[model samples]
Target: MCRMARPRKPLLSRDRIVEAASALVDSEGLDAVSTRRLAAELGVSGPSLYNHFRNKDEILDAVADAVSAQIDLSMFDESDPRDWRAALHDWAVSYRAALTEHPHIVPVLARGPGRRPAGLRVADAVFGAMVGAGWPPAQATYIGALMRYFITGSALGSFARGFVDDETAYDPADYPHLGQAHLLAERRRQVDEGAFETGLRALVDGLSVQYELLAPGGTVRPAPKRS
Candidate 1:
């Protein structure tokens, strides 16, 4: 008697390909990930990977989205506009912490923007928060861009520390304020962590003043006469 072989499971799936690519990026830097490499990692042929993803860029987009999924958006709540500043600072801090875990993927995020859903979702959330707080479109976009630059810049600096040494050896006479700030930062027990929050809040508060000035009929005050 002839017996039918057991049904075979599907040989490939988009989810499986993306997950494997994500793993590669998490372990190795973005430069280390490739379609051929992913296929080999997945025990499949290079062409088989194309059946799911068009090319390396497509795979990268998928991987970025996958990384974004790991983020918890509850860090920002629509219920409170007053804490929008704290919410945003917390969100950025959490994102920095999260990226630190996957140092390899940080570069990909630092470069690519439009291709991934997660990145867009974050932009949307920031804009939405600003709008909910009654900020104009331009102001919201400006704040979002500023925050992006600060967080990504810090991330890249930390990531590149091995190469840069990240030391600030300045004479007190030459940079007294800088020296004072450095000493104060060094004295704090949670300096590294608290530093980001402190700077973020100060940045947001400064921008809020600008937002008010840019509003209709609001007086554009010149720099408060510097003493």
Candidate 2:
């Protein structure tokens, strides 16, 4: 007598598919991912992936949003507006850490702004904090974009080229400026290694200087008021 075959498990779902896809991205580089690859990992056929996601781009967008959800916003809670600099630095560092944790998904974020609820919330929180800190709307937006760009570039570089040597081990005699900063950063790694903090501070400082130069009391002194 022939034996009966075992039935397939009914565990397949969109959420599970996305989770598996995210795991695949975490373990393998983005170039190695595809719907077919995700399906195989999920124990389903390639076409089954489409049943859950419209296409690969949709899957990527979902994955990016999922990664974004991991970012913690509580780092921004501050009583003093002047403390905005420290709070903002902490937020940027945390954001960078979350992105770095899923380095493979960095490209997706760089490619397209994600659609997930958490992703949008993160953006809104950042912009809101900047505005609350007395930055104009446009300046807040620009600052947000600049911070994201810096995080994305660092995450990609750290993944593609490991973090130790380039950022820390430069020769002092040959590159005094880099070497000093590297040593200081190494010490501050206990606090924040200084990538996000340094970059954010410099950007804000530069913007403040520019604003002063352009504002009413600024140094753009009127054009001699002559004929």
Question: Model 1, range 1-227, lDDT digits (tens) per residue?
Answer: 99978747556898988888888887776887888798788787899887877889888877776776666567566665546666777788777777656667666777746857788888888888876666777778888888877876665543222222223655567867654454443444355456666777888788766766654544355656778
Best by lDDT: 2
Structural similarity to truth (TM-score) of each candidate: 0.74, 0.70
In candidate 2 the C-alpha lDDT for residue 211 amounts to 50
lDDT of 2 at 99: 85
Ten residues in a row with the worst lDDT in model 2?
Answer: 158-167
Clashes of each: 0, 0
Candidate 1 residue pairs in clash (backbone atoms < 3 Å)? none
* Each prediction's whole-model lDDT (CA): 0.71, 0.72
lDDT of 1: 0.71
